[model samples]
Target chain A: MTKYVIRRLLQMIPVLIGATFLIFAMVFALPGDPTANKCGERPCPAEYVKKFEEEHNLNDPLPIQYAKYMGKLAKGDFGTSFREIPVKDELSERYVVTAKLATIAILFETVLGIFAGVLAGIRKGKFIDNLVLLSTLFVISIPIFVIGYVAQFLLGVKWRIFPVTVNANATGLDSWWQLLLPGLVLGSVSVAYVARLTRTNLVENLRADYVRTAKAKGLTTSRTIGLHALRNSLIPVVTFIGADFGALLGGAIVTEQIFNIQGVGGYIFSGIHNRDGVVVVGAVTVLILVYLLVNLLVDILYGVLDPRISHD
Target chain B: MSTISTRRGNRAEAAAAPSKYQPQDGLLLEVDDLFVEFHTDDGVAKAINGVSFDLRQGETLAILGESGSGKSVTAQAIMGILDMPPAKIPAGQVRYCGHDLLTMPEDERRKTRGPEISMIFQDALSSLNPVFPVGWQIAEMFRKHRGLNKSESLDRAVRLMERVQIPAAKERVKAYPHQFSGGMRQRIMIAMAIALDPAVLIADEPTTALDVTVQAQIMSLLEELQQEREMGLILITHDLGVVADVADKIAVMYAGRIVERADVYDIYARPGHPYTRGLLDSIPRLDQKGQTLSAIGGLPPNLTKIPAGCAFNPRCRMADHVCRTDLPPLREVEPGRESACHFAEEVLRG
Candidate 1:
């Protein structure tokens, strides 16, 4: 089992590197220039362009630029922005903003996702199951931007329950209440999917001959459900949680932009729109890293669910 | 002696009570006219139709039937484990030791189920939770029913493992169900069943899913346990060979009802019902020489479209027009047996 876990972890490195390299390649290919934008609409002198090119190493080929970026990344110096603010400073500042919201969003999503799943599975074939299924479908069908805008208008604009603009000072669980609706709206679709998957897997687990045997063993209804049914039903649910964590973090861009919360999504938003290559690539890399970590954790839990697979 | 509580112990007094609680001498259980029905979208399908049987101390009663013929349903009903709504006991009685099992409150019935009447299942691998240690699961039964503390229950669980002949009982007690082989898992199931020393043990197809060698091992273990406990055992299966080896009395079921019932010797020597005869002839026997085995002629009749009178009539070779139209009531044809056939004696003539 230890060997298997170590092997799996080792295998993920190349895959992640390949994926991040592709993202870097894609960003490199985008037709724009950060220096040109910084230099403004006035056509700068050839010498000024030459000076900027030499400093940023734009004089090198694409592969050279990539190699340079990788080297700097290895040394933990992400270079500087077009205006000369160190990229590390910008990323750390932006990282805190995202950390503030993503933490709450993930917490909300995980709890809600698991709850919805357990409820739907338990009340299977009933109105509650059908309602949860339909509601989740509705949540998933709506675009995240639409969910964000609508929630902003309804809860922030109309209800005045939360501020229209996300407060920078209010942090932790204190501000979480304000972020809750946006987080819920953005994270809810995944919740629905989790619930649906959980329900299906849960129903399957419930019907497994083991559950029947547990029931016949004179174990009380609740004890049988908690001990025998829940743990066995969790493999698929755990996989989804792990795989979707990155999505919830990286993909909540529209939501953060709308809410005006200066989080990771917002950082990526400005970076992509402004063509700030450092922040864009860094955030994407971090997102991918988080996703990889979650997947690793999920793989570890598979062993806990059924020891036979671990023994294998 | 006559001045004593003769009224309390008399068979006549018991017979006057509810059909379920009518206990005879040393009888551990009695089920009479039990009709279990399942209400699907279409209509009610009788799972166990008017089934009646008795279980005496230390004797194993085998109810033989193919899948869906209600052998397991009868056992579940006796165990009070059958879920209601889709399934229900429409009529009849399940009496355990002069108590009406069907009418007993659920909590009271629950007490009897774990502490006095236990069951073993067909699929040993599936019947156990893969996440937990096998012995811990058994210990749970001890904890719940007997109120044993941690160490005591642990010791009892180890003892149960030893009793079931699981080697390295103390160490193996912590090993999960998946660690054990199929036969060993079934042995674990048997250990759990006997943990509470239940007077009546219902083993549903206990050996069907196991290999022949393991099947024999489980059967011998059960026989030994039966002798030790003097418990009433209800062995549910379709295997004539298994019933021959373990059961004292055999209830041959076709569709839902018992078509034939007799002692083991009588059932094997002279099967009264045509269905029973067809089944006996199918088994490859040591006594019969140089003959290709006989096969039962037809499919198990679809329960939804069961022939009106006798459910087995469609598959019964000796069935006549009367057998197709008139339901044959169970009739005593000999001193110790009963068969549901119009011409049971004549049919046995061949």
Candidate 2:
């Protein structure tokens, strides 16, 4: 198992290198002068342009530039944003906000989705099953932004239950309350997706022969469904949850924009608008790392859930 | 929810049931007029119709039939393990001792499943949960139903494994279903079934998936255990050759009904039903090595559209106008022998 984990960790090196290189190339290969774009609407002086090019290694070839960036990254230097703010410091400040939002949303999504899904799947074709299926379908059909706005209007404007926009200065419980609204908005789509996934997975497992054996063993129907069937069903759900959680952690862009929350998503937007290669590339690299780590965690969880799956 | 609720309601009635009808002396289980149907998009398929049988302790009753003859369905009906929606038992009486299992409350029925009655399914690999260790799965019967604590149940699981003659059972307790061979897995299944020394043990095609040598071993083990516990064994199978030596009585099913039933030796010596005769003749005999084997004409009828009157009328050579118009009920041909055929006497004269 240790060897397997170590091997997987080694394999990530090439993936990380490729992801960083691709993001770098995408930023540099854009039309028009990126250096001028970085300087904003006003044209920069000849000396300022030269200074920027030299400092950022724009004067070097792509390979040398990549090597230089990798060297800097290895030494834990993420460079500065176009606004001259240290990327690392900026990321540290906003990371907590995004983490809190994603965590809350994912927690709600997982608990509600799995619970409803298991019910619908086990009782397939029954009234409660049909109701859950239809509700999930309705949730899935609507766009995220529209859902976000409707939530904001109903929960924030009319009901006055939550603030429409997040309070940046808030801390602890106040901060949690502020995060809840946008989190729900951000997490709603995932809940529907996961519900559908869990329903399909669990329905298949319920029909499996082992489930019949469990019932024949004199287990209560609930216990048979929960302990025997549900564990097997959760194998595929783990994959879905891991990938979705990683994506949420990457940041809910429209959700962040709608809530006016300052997070990594907003950082990426500003980075793209200002043609800040360092910030965009840096944000994407971190997201890729998270995605890989989540997948690895999911694989490990598979070993726990299924005895047939050996780590080696 | 509706399914479970209705089952629970039935369970309540089972608990309230007046202790009026006692089982015939020495009989452990009595299944009377059992009817099972499956409702599908196509139509309702009558799987088992009016199937009745009696099982006595320390005896093995082999239910012989081809595929789709309702042998397995009867077993499932008796065990109360058939899935609903697809399956529905309109009318049946599965009485264990004096208790009606069909009307018995869910909790009461559950109590009966592993202790009063237990079942061993055909395919062991598919039947055993893939994720749990074999011992854990076996111990689960004791844990949930018997109210044994974890370690105690686990110890019992190990003992059961040893009793079933699983090699290195102490070490193999942690092994999963996929790790064991087909026979070993079936042995594990048998161990679990007999764990509580159930009064009636139904093994639905237990040796169907095993090799010939392993089949004999499994049967011998089952016989040994049945004698030890004085357990009534209901062996459901398609193979007549396997049951001849082991079964005390044989019930031959055709379509959804029992066409013939007799003592093992008598049934072989003289089958009163044409369908039973056909089944016996079809077996490849050593003396007729070069002769082409006899096969029953046509397939079993489509369950949704079983032919009118006798289900075997289409296949029986002696099927007549009387056979075409009226279903032959199972009638006594001799003491301890019954056959469902209009011309049972003519067939018996052979």
Highest lDDT model number = 2
* Native RMSD of candidate 1 (Å): 5.0
lDDT of each: 0.80, 0.87
Instruction: Put down candidate 2 lDDT per residue, B137-182, tens digits, no spaces.
Output: 9999888866789998888889899999999999999999999999
The TM-score values for the models, in the order shown, are: 0.92, 0.94
CAPRI-style grade of the A/B interface in model 2: medium
lDDT of 1 at A95: 67
Q: What is the Cα-based lDDT of residue B214 in candidate 2?
A: 100
Native-referenced Cα lDDT, model 2: 0.87
Docking class of 1: medium
DockQ for each numbered candidate? 0.56, 0.71
The TM-score of predicted model 2 comes to: 0.94
TM for chain B in all models?
0.91, 0.92
For model 1, which pairs clash?
A98-A264
State the displacement of the C-alpha of residue B123, model 1, in Å, after optimal TM-score superposition: 0.7
The recovered share of true contacts, given per candidate in order, is: 0.60, 0.90
Tens-place lDDT digits, model 2, residues A1-312: 889899999999999999899889889767767567555688888898889889889888897898898899788898998788988888877888999999999898999999889889977889988998899999999999999999999999999999989878899899888899999888888888788888898999898888888888899988999989998888888778877888888887899898888888898888888888889987888888888998898888778888898887
lDDT of 1 by residue, A160-267 (tens): 887787777786666767777767766767788888888888888888878877777777778777778988887777777766665665646777778877677777
